[model samples]
Target: MENKFKKITSLWIITVLILFVVAIILGLLMRFNQGGNIKLDPVTFYTDMTIHGLTMIGIWFVAGMAAVNYIMERYVRTSYKANLIAYIMTVVGVLMLWGAGFIGKFHAGWTFLYPLPFKIMWEQWATPLFLYALLVLGVGWTIWTVSLMISLLKKYTLSQVFAWQHFKRDAKPEVETPPFVLISMISLVGVLSCLITAAALDFLLLTEYYSNGGFINDALLMKNLTYFFGHTLANEMLYLGLAVIYELFSEVSGRPKWKTSWYVAYAWNLTLFFVLFAFLHHMYMDFVQPETLQIIGQLASYLASIPSTGVTIFSILVAVYGTKINWNLANLMFFIGTAGWVSGGIGAVIDATISNNFLLHNTLWVPAHFHTYNALGNVLFSLGFFYWFSFQLKDGIIKDKHSMLKILLIVIGGIGFLAAFYFAGADSVARRYANYPEEMASGKFWATFGGTFATIYLLGIILFIGGILKRCFGFVFSRV
Candidate 1:
């Protein structure tokens, strides 16, 4: 009989794949209509994009956390009360959000920014529906978090080393906090701040006080909280993904012996502390926010990025030094993905510079850098992890060569498309618009070229999805 824990992991992976494909399709189409000023297509645009973002977040980050929680629980033999409930809530919450957004019944983005509901841009029920979905999703996430932590506490028996020490060297490191826990802690704060931000917005909606001149103040407050959560969540994914990559790579290659493990962990922990304060970078272009706030944000933003980038590059080099590195598809992706991440980081630092932000804000440059760094960087690592785990499963089955080829094509095509977008952005193209003006003809040309590559990228996705289906239905359930 298969283990219950293994079954959960499999389910989560399937969920992640469905969400990933949805996100990719939406991403491509959104880029395709880059020049049009269409807010909602009145049918598919708002809901599809909203669901795409939220579900991708849940599947990629939230569901990944669920899997991690399950793994930790299994390691510690934790109880499973409400475990099934947690999964159910997550699925249901996503569906509700999708239905609301797609059916034209509601059209809020995943962020559901302030003054959204009071402004009456969409249906009256959108606010309530969104709040309900939040309630359901939050419960599920809280369950997973509590379950994992309590189980770990029992296993460690009040000792900080075993309880909170996510990584240790020499098999007896003397620290209580580790990078994983610190990231988790930061994520908790991010989530809470977002929730509070949502609550504040909800209050305005209920009272309709925005027409009474509360909009500006509320917007700023909400913006502050939103950016805080947004920046931290994005940064946390990179740090966590890097940690996982370092460990997995070392284990696979059998080198470096985990000597620098604590330093890497410490880097992530301290780095996030700086990330929280860097929220002001988003406000660099805002008119009302104080100049001091912007300066503080820029400083924190630059300071935070240093440790993460430093730890990742130096550690990977030391780990791989003098080793006969294998060129498996997954390993290749990891190495290239790291490079993409670093490139994005460079763009990010530049964007945070006050003068640069003035020129870059609201331009394609912003999305170009972020998509390259967070979407491509973090998601690519996650994909690598998926491939690695498939091979590592006790079933001992590996993805076929056809699957590997598809992944390679997708990576190549996607990067080409994104690079073009970056160039367009640098040339002062704006995002979220459907049609380019004559003033930006050259930029639009390159952007269209990039969009063409994206359409081709979908072909690679089809191949990858087909391979997965074949493996699960034809091979896994077939007679060995």
Candidate 2:
């Protein structure tokens, strides 16, 4: 079983890295096209956009889940079969999704916003194929999530899994809930909720398509559900990476494992609750959306971010501040990743604000913030886990020959790339255009600049993947 687990995990790492590299290339293509460096037809550019967005989101999400599941084995027995199932489904679904885009020319963008999919400029069958792909991915992920939750439950009671015992002052329980278990459970709940939302959204979409004229779905509700799934899942995946960090950061740093205190428990619980509602912010532009919900969305966005960010940052600081800690690639990534997450989060908050949203809505700023977190933040978190997991498998440290160089490239490249988006966004450059219009001429320059830096970022990721690939190949092939 252990060997099987390692092999499965090795396969996951390989698949994710391959998909990630492809997604990065697609993104760079879009940026170059926008800069007028390349001239892709409108349909082709949008097709790349759709695939690039969904693929990046899908791969990174599973990357975090795979990392979490591997580490969760330390606390509870996870189902290897479920892990494998998700792997198979992810590959199959991605194929179908790409076929829908690349082959069928379904280019409605990743959001596939309510009316857009229906306005078929592509193959008539492409829309349903895309929806079906989502269904396939959703089912597999739901099964894996439920399996992990059940595993945790088998070892700890409901309240214990949530660390309710820590809520009471000076109270100690017979079995202490590790910070990892608590955060994992919290994150898993959010993951399950969003997957269900995705399932429901897909169902409605499919229903409307088949219904033809018999039934029509409300645009507002569909849009609401779309962001509910997309925004929530995106945020939850980051939390999933954070869960891995909480578990492995200290261990990799040669420090004591983090413990769940009352504040830690409180903060995560608050996160779980508020995150569910944070998606409402996306509906702020819809005047038809209830004013009350809009207000709640603004508040929830702020509330959802504060507790987790505050507590986690404090914990990390306490762990390393002024201490002669062992600083290696893994922990260093965690440290830098936290900074990235915070930076992106601040950008998100700025845009989530009602007053600011009026100015930044649909601007490149939207991508700027999310890319900051995903590219620099959550990506680093998973990379840290990947390196650590590979290290364990080898039972010997494979020295990163140019570790400093890798970090320097990633940091410089990531910042430069994001800065272009930020600057263009602040200048009110609209996103999702294949080419910048004359009025937004500055956007062309920024896109070219961003693409150049993103190539540098891709080089850094390649180096990281090369090191992991060597170790993973050995682990999968070796007979223990």
Candidate 3:
């Protein structure tokens, strides 16, 4: 079972890295085009944007899910057939998606915001094909999440899985639920909700597309549903990475495992509730959304980040602050990853505020915060897991040499890249523009600079993943 877990995980890691690199290249091209370093047709640029967004989101979400599924098997049995089905479906979905975008020239942003997909400025066939691709991926991922949830329930009851028993003082629950199980369950439930919403929205879009004037979707509702899935998945996937952290952080640092307590239980439970409404923040400018919901969005955004990030950071600090601990690449990645998550999250909160949203609406800052969390935060979390999992399958942190140098590259590069976005955003650089006009010349310089630093960041990822990948491949192919 352990060996099988390893094989499946290694395959996931391999697939994620390959697609991630491709997405990075597409991002670099976008930057270069914007910076006047290179020029791409507007259609080509948007096509790249669509694929880059879709691929990055898809790969990272799967990476988090894969890690949790692999780690969860330690406590409960998992369905290999479900995993295989998801694996196959994901590949097919991605292929169909790529064909639609690249071959058929679907230039709609991965967001595929309503009315725009129907605009049909691109190939007529691209619209329906693109929608179907989403259907394929959504079904596969939804099944995978539900199956994992079922696997957990088979061992532990719903209340136990949620760690509701931990809420009471000195509560001796008949069964102990690991923090990993708690977070994974919370995240899986969120995924299921968001995916269901995604399916509904997709159905609406398809209905309108096929009806040929016989049907229509409410634009506001579609936008609401879109961000609900998009924002929730983005945040929930981060939690998925955090689940890996809760499971591995202390263990990798040679410290004891983190136990589920009242506070931990409270924070995650609050997360599950509040994050569901945090997506409202994205629609704050719609003007048509209820003012009450907008208020709820701001509050939910704050409450969600505060309790969850606060507790996680507090736990990490307590575990490492005065202890003689094992600090390897794995633990270091996790530690630094937490800092990145908090930093990016703070930025997100600032933007969520209504007053601030009025100023920063749809600027480079939008990408700034997300990239900070993703590139530096969630990506690091998964990388940490990959480092730990690969070495556990091979050498147990034997490749500790030049670790500081690698960390240095990642830190310097990430900070540099993000700084560009921050500065450009503050200067009011518009996002998603293929080329900046003479008025936004500074945007060009920043874009070029960001691209350069991102290359450095990519170098660090390459060097770090190099050995991990070798070991993973070896493990994947090794005879049991």
Winning model by lDDT? 2
98-170, model 3: which lDDT tens digit per residue?
9999999998898899989999888899999999999999999988999999999999998999999999868
Candidate 2 global TM-score: 0.99
Error of 2 at 176 (Å): 0.7
Kindly report which residue stretches of model 2 are placed more than 4 angstroms away from their true locations once superposed: 396-398
RMSD of each: 4.2, 1.0, 1.1
The lDDT of each candidate is: 0.63, 0.93, 0.92
Ranking by TM-score: 2, 3, 1
Q: Per-residue lDDT tens digits of candidate 1, residues 35-96? A: 34224363355556566667766666654464344434423565455566667788898877
Candidate 2, 1-480: lDDT as tens digits: 377888888889988898999999999999999999988999999999999999999998999999989989988999999999999999999999999999999999999999899999999999999999999999999999999999999999999999999987687878899998998999999999999989998998898899977989999999999999999999999999999989888887789889889999999999999999999989888999989999999999999999999999999999998887888888889999999999999999999999999999999999999999999999999998888788778664635668898999899999999999999999999999998889999999999999999999999999877889888989888887
| lDDT at 12, model 1 | 60
Model 1: per-residue Cα lDDT at residue 268 = 63
- TM-score of model number 1: 0.83
Instruction: Name the lDDT of candidate 2.
Output: 0.93
